[model samples]
Target: MEQILANGVYLGSQYAMIALGLTLIFALMNVLNFAHGQMYVIGGFVTYTFYGQWGVPFVLALFMSCVTLAILGALIERFLFAPVIKGSSREESTMLLAAGIAFFLDAVILLVFGEKQRGVPKIVDGVFNYDFRLIMPYDRILICVLAILSIVAFIGLMQYTKTGRALRALAQDRTAAQLMGVNVDRYSMIGFALGAMLAGLVGGLLVTITGVNLGMGGPTSIKAFMMVMIGGAGVISGAIWGGIILGFMEAIGLALLYQYGDITYLLIFVSLMIFLAIRPQGLMGKPWG
Candidate 1:
């Protein structure tokens, strides 16, 4: 039980970081970024290259991952999304664009990184055990702590910073925010970049434990979407809640998997479908205006 709980917390923290990026982008642009998982994979690859291959320090490699993804995100928003958003009359167009971007990123990742899985050397070498019941690797603990700190820092940024305020205003009401002199285009790009950066950061942090591969992108996005839906789409706190809930569910399901076999995921997803059917707006989200 203790092991399960610890696993839940560890998984929840990392999952929340992934969900946060998706929710932030959704809140700001009303766009579901299918390419988000690709961005995460890129982050992991970047870190793997610099830290695992080039022998750079892990922290610097992580920074490079964040920088690389942030630039990619900014460019994508400026060149692809911004124009489509301005020209399109139908929201479906944006969704299509997102899908296209996802495919493009997948192709790029495969071409550049190949199909092989990649992992980094453990940053810390040890284990933490409490009464032999709650045992975890030292590196996982470090990553979990960093993930939590990153989330808290993000929350603080949203609540206290000027950039965050502008982004929030834009998210709340684009027309009203524009009327009040907010630069919608500038802030939108910034928000998207920030969202991508968060994804990269989490990818870098988890690469030590999970070891990223090119194929993980689609499933990662799906799981992130599940977390977003569980908490409430486009709601930050809801994303966190959804992540933690899904994390615990995964932990429990895995624990039962040996006994129950494939029914574990079936049950978990079915429960989510039922919950969404009952409350489509989600736990914290209001109906779209």
Candidate 2:
């Protein structure tokens, strides 16, 4: 049970990292970015190429991958989201464009990578032995620590930094924020860049935990969307809570179903449906007026 709990927390941290990025983008943009999972996968591939193939240090590879994706995200925001936002049909256009971009990227990846599952070398080897016979991987512990730090840093930025304040202002009301001298376009680009960087970081860590392949992004994206919906669309705290809840639920659900010889995917779908039905706005979501 102790080991199970430890594993759950570790997995929860990973899920939190991915879900936080989704939450941030959705909170400010009010659009679900279907391309996020692809970004995550691309980050892992970038890390693998830089670190594994080019022999760069793991930390440096992670940094470079994030930076590269951040730039890509800025470009995407400028070219793809900008026109959609300015057009007459805002929501529909934005959704369709993002989804199309996601599909196109996925196809490109499939052609390039050829559906091979590949894992990155662990950042840290060996396990930490806890008192009472509990053993946990040092890398997983690092993930949990990083997760906490990332959340703290993000919160601190939002609460204390000028740019963060501008982001919050834009999130609350774009027109009002623009009138108040916030550069809406620049801020939106920055927010999207940060979101992409977070996805990249999580992707690098994910490669250490599980092998990556072209097809993995789709399921992960579905799970992330479910988590964002369950947590609330526009609330950071909601994302955090929803991520942890879903992570533990998934872990426990899989364990139980394994004992009963039931299908894991079915359980996941059923739980998602139940959550959607019970709280359409999600647990921490404010009702849309």
Candidate 3:
């Protein structure tokens, strides 16, 4: 039971991070980023290169990847995504463009990294064991702590600061925000950057547990999409909730279904479908105005 709970919480944090990125991007741009997972993949690779290969401190490697991914995200927004948003019907175009970007990045990673999976050595190797039953590792503990801090910081940014106000305003109403001189374009870029940073951070963290490979992005992206939908579209809090639920479900599935890992996702899909059939806007989503 303790083991199950620990795995659930650890996985929940990763899912929340991924879901948060997707929600942030969707809230601002009114489009889903098909390539967002690629950023996560690249982030893990960057950390592997630094911490695993160059012998940089693990925390330092994470920081380096965070900064690099932020810059890369901004560049992607400016060059790849921004151009498509100007079209008469940008919702579809932006999504398609992002899909194109994801495919291209996947190919590039495959060519560069090859088919081999890469591992990130433990930053610290020790387990917290109590009563010979409860056990937790330091790295997973760190993942959860960082996840909490990131969520808190994200909420603070959205609620308290000036730039955060601008982002909130843009999300609530782009045309009205523009009329109020909020600069939707700039805020959208910032949102994308922040979202990408979150995804990259998760990627780096997950490499410690799941290792790094070209295919990691696809399943993660799908799970994130499920989280965003199940939690509630355009609702950050919903993503967090959805992530936790999904994580717990997966953990339980592992305990009960054991050998049927795929059943977990199938169950999630069925649950989501049933929920949507009853409430199309999602768990916390307000009907589109």
Candidate 4:
């Protein structure tokens, strides 16, 4: 029980970070970024190349991942999504564009990174064991702590920064924000970049634990979408709650169903369907338009 609880907390923290990025993008642009998981995989690859292969410092590698993804995200928003949003009459256009972008990124990843799994060296060694009750790896603990700190920092940025204020204003109402002197195009790009950066950050953090591969992108995106739906579409706090809930669900389910041979995810999806049917708005999310 103690181990399960500890595992839940660790997994929940990282999952929440992933969900945060997806929810942030949705809140700002109303676009479901199917490429989000690809961005994450790219981040991990960058970290693996630098920290794992080239002997660069881990911090520097992580920074490079964030910068690379941020730039890519900004360029995608500036050249692709923004124009499509303005030119298209159908909402499905954006979804289609997102799907196309996901495919493009997947191809890019395959061409550049190949199909092999990649990971980084653990940042810490040893395990934290308490009389066989609650045992965890030191690297996992460090990553979890870093993820939580990142979350708190993100929340603080949203609540107290000038750029955050501008982004929030844009998200709340684009026309009103423009009327209030906010640059909608610029802030939208910034929001998308920030979201991508968050995805990269988490990917870099988790590379030490789970590793990453080209095939993980689609499933990762699906998991993030599930978290968003569970928490409430376009709600930030809901994303966090959804992530934590899903993480614990995974932890407990896996622990309990290890003997059942991969039925845990099947159970999770079934539960999610039931939950959504019962309360579509989620725990704290208002219905998004």
Candidate 5:
């Protein structure tokens, strides 16, 4: 039971970290980026190529992956999102463009990497024993620590920095923020890039625990979307609350059914229904205007 609880916390932290990027983008852009998952997959592939294939140091590879994705996110904001928003029908065009990007990236990945699973070499190996009875991988502990640090850094930035104030202003009202000389366009690009970087970081971390493949992003993206929705669309705290809840729910459900056979999908569906019906605004969601 202790092992199961520990494992659940570990997995939940990863889920929360990944979901944070998605929530940030949603809050700022009000667009559901279906392609966020592809960015994650691409980040893993970058790490695999640089570190796994080219013998680059793991830390450097991780940095490179994050930087590359951040640039890609900026490009996407400029070319893909900006145009759609400037068009006659912003909402429809934005969704379609994002969906198109998702499909295109998925195809590109399938062509380049093929359909095989590949794991990123572990950053740290060996296990730590607690009370000389239970053993857990150091890697999992590292993931939890990273997750906590990331969350703290994010919250600090939002609370203390000028850029954070701009982000909040934009999130609340873009036109007003622009009127205040916040440079909404530039800030949007930066926000998008930051979002991508976060996703990539989560990707690198994931590679250490689970193997990566071309098809891995789709499901994870869907899960992140579900987490965002359950947390609330425009609330940062909602994302954290929703992600932790979903992660623990998933972990507990899996453990419970490990002996009873496969019921993962069913459990997920039930949880979703219960959350939606009981707390449609989510645990930390702000009241809608």
Candidate 6:
């Protein structure tokens, strides 16, 4: 039971990382960012290419991957999303553009990396035996610690910084923010870059835990979307809570379902669907102050 809880927390953190990024972009740009999964895989591959292949330090490699993706994300926004975000239409345009971007990135990475699985060398090797039934891995522990720290830092940024204030204002109301001289364009860029950086960071974290493959982006995107929808469509806090719910549900389902672990998502999604039908506003979506 303890091990399952631990796994839930670890997996939940990962889901939060992805869902957080997704929520940021959606809040500011009204775009779902289907390309995020590609960014995630790219982050892992970038870290691997540097640390696993080029002899760079693990920490440096992670930083490099994040920097690389951050730049990529910014450039993408500058070129593609900027127009759509400020234009008359939204839903279809953003989805089409983002999907195209996703496909392009996926193809490029597939051509470069081929069909191979790459793993990050265990930076912190070994396990803790909390007795026979409750052993835990250092990597998993590190992931949880890093996740908590990241969440705290993110909250601090949102709560205590000028930029954070601007972001919050925009998230609350873009037109009002623009009226208040909030430099919506600049903050938009900042939000996208931050979201992409988080995506990249989680990618590297995934590599550290279980390696990465070429075809991870699609499912990753789905998981992020699920978290966001379940928690609340546009609420930042909802993403975290949604991720925890999904992670815990997934863990519990896997434990109980055993060999039929794949059924976990089906069951959870059904439950979420029923819940959402009753409360379309999501857990933290509506009634915002």
Best by TM-score: 1
Q: Find the 10 residues in a row with the least total lDDT in model 5.
A: 280-289
What is the clash count for each candidate, in the order shown?
0, 0, 0, 0, 0, 0
Q: Mark the regions of model 4 whose C-alpha exceeds 4 Å error after superposition.
A: none
lDDT of 2 by residue, 1-289 (tens): 6766776787777887788888888888887888889989988888887887788998898898789789988999988898788774568788888789889878988887677887777889998988855688888888788877887888899899998999899888889999999999999999999888888888876777775788877777777787788788878877877778777876776766787676766777787788778878888897781
lDDT of candidate 4 over 226-271, digit per residue (tens): 9999998778888999999999999999999999899989999999
Better by TM-score, candidate 5 or 4: 4
| Model 6: per-residue Cα lDDT over 143-234, one tens digit each | 88888788778878988999989998999899999999999889999889988988998898779887889889999999899899888976
Candidate numbers, best TM-score first, in rank order? 1, 4, 6, 3, 5, 2
Error of 2 at 212 (Å): 1.6
**Shift in Å, residue 84, candidate 6:** 2.6
TM-score of 5: 0.94
Please identify model 2 stretches exceeding 4 Å from their true place.
129-133, 263-265
lDDT of each: 0.93, 0.82, 0.84, 0.91, 0.83, 0.88
User: Which is the better candidate, 1 or 2, if ranked by lDDT?
Assistant: 1
Superior by TM-score: candidate 1 or candidate 3: 1
Q: Where does the lowest 10-residue lDDT sum fall in candidate 4? A: 280-289
**Against the true structure, candidate 5 has what lDDT?**
0.83
TM-score of 1: 0.98
Residue 266 CA error for candidate 6 (Å)?
A: 2.1
Query: Candidate 2: global Cα-lDDT?
Result: 0.82
**Between which residue pairs do clashes occur in model 4?**
none
Q: What TM-score does candidate 4 reach?
A: 0.97
89-157 per-residue lDDT for model 5 (tens digits): 657777888889889989988998788998877778999998855568898788788877888898899
Q: For model 3, which pairs clash?
A: none
Please, what is the TM-score per model?
A: 0.98, 0.93, 0.94, 0.97, 0.94, 0.96
